[model samples]
Target: MKRKYSPYTLPPWLRKVRGACAQFIIPICVFQGIRTILFPFTLDVLLLTLLILLAVALHLNVI
Candidate 1:
């Protein structure tokens, strides 16, 4: 059987880093989305997609 995941199991510094990333991720996603919309460059699109995936993973605590 697989063990359950717990944020408390993480080191203090890693938890802090995760907290900071969670706080900042949304705004960064929004900005990347806007930039992707305005520019539509291939690189920008790829970056935005990666950021969105990261945000979803973070939200789901799958990181």
Candidate 2:
């Protein structure tokens, strides 16, 4: 018989970091998106947040 691993499991430390990034950064990105939609001023913040989101997503294999 062969053992199998569940793909949902992650290392404890990594899980914490990934959870935090998702919880914190995702909301911020959403708000930034709204800000850009409402008032088209200073897109730098929106761009930065999107970049961060992309980086975090790549790191977590969410994309």
Best by lDDT: 1
lDDT of 2 at 63: 43
Ten contiguous residues with the weakest lDDT in model 1: 54-63
Report the lDDT tens digits of candidate 1 across residue range 1-63: 999989889999999999899889999999999999988999999999998998998999987
Q: In candidate 2, what are the lDDT values of residues 1-63, reduced to their tens digit? A: 975544257788876776666667766667777777777676756585676767677556664
TM-score, cand. 1: 0.90
Give the Å error, residue 5, model 1: 2.3
**Which clashing pairs does model 1 show?**
none
> Clashing residue pairs, candidate 2?
none
How do the predictions measure up, each by TM-score? 0.90, 0.45
Off by over 4 Å in 1: none
